[model samples]
Target: MKRLCTLVAAVLVSTSLTLRAQAEETINYITAGGIYLENIQKAYLDPVGKQLGIKWSVETNDVDTPVRVQVQSGAVTTDLVEFGASTCALGGAEGLYEKLDYSVIDNSELAPGTFSDYYVGSTIYSMVIAWNPKKVPNPPQNWADFWNVEKFPGTRSLYRNAFYVLEAALLADGVPKDKLYPLDLDRAFASLAKIKPHIKAWWASGAESQQLVREGGIDMIGMFNARAQSVISDGGSLAYTFNEGLIDFGCWSIVKGTPKKDLVMKVLAEFVKKEHQADMTLLSNYGAANTKIEETGKIPADLAPLLPTSAENYPKQIVTSAEWWAKHGAEAKERFDQFLAE
Candidate 1:
């Protein structure tokens, strides 16, 4: 009787492993969503799925709300998500993601701070000043210039979030980039007060940022580099500058409690390849997370200077401090909400 029971338990364990492996065959990816989805599909998802012999689908969704809902409800439908770097810290803290398996996913290709225990950076993107040149020939060269309405003189837009807004405020107020964090919210909000009246719209999405640029609702706007580049490529009257651009990455994190981690890790491996990363850069103008993208000889010489990680422009911007934000994001958001209301 004891031997029969032990054999039955062994069979049950074997059947569970087999079922999980079968479940890993189809992978689902969640993205922050917008113009990025098309390219991400073309450059990374479609190709990787083919190469790995796995079926794949993607959802265009808000990374934070839906992910939190899915994780907390224990109905995790997606295998992986493209998270803002700071969101990775928040999600990990909330136990929303699996700790990454480094043995399967290589980190050597990633830049410093882009790799974390639960996630790995997939693309390096920038938030910059995108403008209609007809509206303002003399561009805001830096954050200080952006705050100077009397000199540049244009309606503006900024993201609705406090992350970049606070940093820009501090930089415009003459704080050096190197000294940016443990951010002085008191001073940053004071700087924001000066330009708040000039801001035409506090955009909530990437698509809105691009629309603001293309429709000429605002003369110059704080925008994402890739969104600006997408407009520029489409012959929209848009141009962008790199100075004071906030450099951050979108990283891949497996949803906690997913049954497909093994295959999800395989997808990440393919996503970060120099070739696939280069493919994305060509499509979106986001610099590849794989640093060796330069050495891949895939990017055109003319385009090299525009990448956020490019040698010529990287020095002009500030790298956001995820560690600092991870600790203070909630407090800052609370104050920013009150400030905006007041």
Candidate 2:
């Protein structure tokens, strides 16, 4: 009888250990580092980890190289990742991400056209025209005005990326908002050439743009709205306009062959909850992709108009097409680089 009792006790102990191990499974996620990742960790990952009794390990990489390496090796270590819209579309087309199981992940709360079968929009940001009001008392209201050096005269800074630069050029050339896509590359480049001589710098990062504006290195710039807001918050003598702003967003996707797809989906759904989405905006000053935040008044009234998706600002901006860019961007980039050289 004593031997039989001991055997039963050992079996119970083994079962308990197995269940605990399963419950404590850890997920690895990758994202762009800096304040964006910090905010996501604080508002989404940490809370979800506590509530769901799961563990998440995060790594930072600005590009998709790490994910590509893992997928090619047939040994994906990162279960999920966040990347720009262009990268998301390209990766999706290349089958680098899993086909999201929408049945398990509810995206009803997200903004219209924000999520796809392979990814969900994580945050929204914009590129707008920023200027030092002291230098140019009369600010340019739209892209067309921005091109009129005679009126808003000063050295300018523009993003190094071909995508935003081309779109801005098209708009400045009087391309209607509805007609901007399937972009007129020849006309866009022609327009860019007219202003190229006036441009003082081609900024490669948000920090560079901000620094140039803050130090009076450039009188006007094409820059991110969040960076401009930082200048305003610091009481700098800079101002920006949303008219003709270029709306862009980042997305979260599951790695193609992750064995933990179901678990990752659950975690993703949690991360995009209305409350957590609101928290993300508050922490990072970027717009939430969840439309419910607007209705729920989670976004403060003062900050609403500043968001790229806000009703007042939405119509004034051009929403970029990730799919179109994914298809034609390479050629456009090559042409743009050659144009710059000449």
Candidate 3:
């Protein structure tokens, strides 16, 4: 009987030690600060950590400089990171990220083409035309209407970033949507010149765009959907159109040499779960990359139109091609800067 008791005690000790080992495991995740991080923590990291008996150390940094530094130095601390589509493409090519294990990190819930071998889509944000309905009784319906200062006469705001600005300019100049790529710099610049004097502010951040509209600083602007939604929710008399919207997305990636690659992949799988994705939208106003979440009917009807990935909105907008931008962004940006100066 004593031998029996000792065997049982040993079994219990082994189980306890294994559980403790599991509980002590940790993964470092880096993402943009503010509501994006907050929502991820509440909807994913905290809950998933509890379920998996692991800990997640959260950090915030928008740029991929830290990840790049870690990769070059051969001492990687970050396990997972959030990157914009273009940055992910550049980093993936440089071998800065690990090829994702889709078997463990399911991509089935995400929109088609949102997941690649090295990255998985995290959120969908878009550049939409936002206007104060009171200021412009007839809001600009499309990019062309935005450029027509004579018809919708008012102060305007645009992103300081050159990529979307050039795209918008080309579209406003009557370039067919199907032929937007291989952007015509000369024509885009010519189109921009017509609206240059009317642009009251060149916004560099989402907050700046939101402030301009909320305070009535700009009558119409090309702004982020998340920012515009904030303004609208604050009782600001603003309306945004998804027509001719420029779709942009950010993705999640794992550091190439992280020791916890398998565990990190499991965490990523949780990030794209329908429930977590839907909850993220409630907190950040950014669209869920998981298309399945739309069918869940958790997102409010009024808020659906604002999501860049919504069935109705997604079809009407142009998905920004990260590949094309990677190839020609520098030259386009240089020309755009020169146009701004002149």
TM-score of each: 0.90, 0.91, 0.89
Question: Please, what are the lDDT tens digits per residue for candidate 1 over residues 36-150?
Answer: 8888988987888778878777787665788888888889888889878888878887788998888888888878788888888888989998888988999888888989999
Count of backbone clashes, every candidate in sequence: 0, 0, 0
Candidate 3 lDDT by residue in tens digits, 71-182: 9999999999997887787788789999988888878778876778888998888999989888899889999999998888888999987878989999998999989988
Q: After superposition, how far is residue 192 of candidate 2 from its true place, in Å?
A: 1.0
**Candidate 2, 222-320: lDDT as tens digits:** 998888988888888789888999988989999999999888989888877888888888777788788887665667888886777788887888889
Q: What is the C-alpha lDDT of each candidate?
A: 0.86, 0.87, 0.86
Candidate 3's C-alpha lDDT? Answer: 0.86
- For candidate 3, the TM-score is 0.89
lDDT of 2: 0.87
With a 3 Å backbone cut-off (N, CA, C), the pairs that clash in candidate 1 are none
User: Which prediction has the highest lDDT against the true structure?
Assistant: 2
Model 1 TM-score on a 0 to 1 scale: 0.90
Model 1 regions lying over 4 Å from their true place: 1-24
lDDT of 1 at 301: 91
Candidate 1: worst-modelled 10 consecutive residues by lDDT: 55-64
